[model samples]
Target: MTDSSKWFESLRVSYEQGELNESDITHNPFEQFNLWLQDAINNDVPEPNAMVLSTVNKQGQPSARNVLLKSADENGFIFFSNKTSDKATDLKHNPHCSLLFSWLPQHRQVIVKGKAEEISMQDSNSYFQTRPYGSRISAWVSDQSKVIKNREELEVKVKEFMDKYPENVPMPSHWGGYLVKPESIEFWQGRPSRLHDRIRFTKKANNWTIERISP
Candidate 1:
């Protein structure tokens, strides 16, 4: 084997940071998530609300990308993106998706499985208004997931939009938010000796069932 291959195999971690127990967590997965999220923030985990959103297209091809979590509550997790983007197109065909929040510094991860649905236009506009002026202007410039000629073309379009909407930029019709209604949420905490703790909460009817699963 090559020296680089040997080096890769030699790298390992013991994961002695923490342990997760069933009795220690709240019955509500959302509450548990909040607690862990706060811990992540307290520990200075970068972009604590960022999550990996996984979606599958109609043809069974899978795609995963990082999206910032805008809000979370009993309703579910909310995020925003271009409505015409590849992820949005995938959601239109198949709403079923998964979200992963990895706090590597804390040796913890949260996995969420759910279905995504578009939020109201009013909500989208509310969030859009809060964004910075440049971001709002750029939103109107690029047609997400579409091919463009070059960087110059993109910069020219941005300039055009900036001049067009000099002061107050309106929210584009093609931009919106999505709510992922979670069906199952699993909290994973790494432990020593390659063993980990996993606590899962599954939704059934109007209540949630909690259980411990093998790591």
Candidate 2:
């Protein structure tokens, strides 16, 4: 198998579903995301808040995973993960990270690069309580990113936690929230013939500069 041949293999679709015009869009990147998110909701795009979070360790090894965007604004996009997880460890060592949201149904994508910060424990508790009981229990049971013997051991832990706390579970101290404060945010809309629309908002010493990018 050759790499170039595999790379050219296609499950391609012509992006005729959505169009982007210079007339419609907000100056702020967050505002644009909010508009797109609302459209996704209206169109019944499944799990529209979900986005790919990319992080790197101190050694510059990058990792990525799909995570739900719990919050977003000028401060940047927010998501939560276990403090003991590899992602958390990586963030501790390197605060810079990026997030990508591909709203394919709308033929759109957004990319953000930023520095991450941990939010208050009080905030974590508030969101934790909103999660389903099973999810809360799973957070307690799983030693996220840690090595376990097998599924049986994990099941045992879940069972033990469930039996001990049938109705309510307190949010773990180590489990909390993190926010990414963006340095730059780009909005991309797919156009025909591989000529895409890309608009970028870059932060400067005191202001944000907007520019159109080559696709």
Candidate 3:
């Protein structure tokens, strides 16, 4: 085997940050998520709200990308992007998706499986208005997930949009937000000797059922 392969196989971490007990976790998965999120923030974890979003296309091909979490509430987790992008196209065919938040500094991770739904235009615009002017313009300029001749072409498009909307750049109709209504959420805490703790909550109707699964 190659040296890199050997190094990869040898790399290991003995997780001893903390232990997760059933009694310590909140019955409500959302509540537990908030508690852990706050803990991550307190621990100075970088980009605590960042998550890996996984989606599947029509052909059953899966794709995963990192996105920043904009908001989280009883309703669901919210994120925004171009509705015409590749991820958005995947969501159109398959609304089902998974979100993973890895707080490695604390040796904890959260996984959420859910259905994606578009948020209201008002909500999208509200968030859009808060973004920097350049970002707002770029959102309209770049046709996300499309091929371009070169960087010059993209920069030219940006300049055109910037010139067109010198002030008060409007949110494009194709750019919006999506909310993931979680059907199942899991909390994982790492332990020594690879004996991790995993607690999952599954939603049914309006209630949730909690269970502990093997590590």
RMSD in angstroms, candidate 2? Answer: 2.4
Question: Per-residue CA lDDT of candidate 2, range 153-202, in tens?
Answer: 98999999999989999999879899999999898999887888888889
Evaluated with TM-score, which candidate comes out highest? 1
Candidate 1, superposed: residue stretches over 4 Å from native: none
Writing each residue's lDDT as its tens digit, candidate 3 over 1-215 gives 57897797788888999988999988989889999999999999999999999999999999999989999889999999999999999999999999999999999999999999999999999999999999999899889999989999989998999899999998999999999999999999999998999999999888999999899
What's the residue-level lDDT of 170 in candidate 1?
96
lDDT of 2: 0.88
Candidate 1 vs candidate 2, lDDT winner: 1
**lDDT of candidates 1 onward, in order:** 0.95, 0.88, 0.95
Model 1 RMSD in angstroms: 1.1
lDDT of 2 at 191: 89
Worst 10 residues of 1 by lDDT: 1-10
List model 1 lDDT by residue over 93-171, tens digit each. 9999999999999999999999999999999999999999999988898799999989999999998998899999999
Residue pairs clashing in model 1 are none
Candidates in order, TM-scores: namely 0.97, 0.92, 0.96
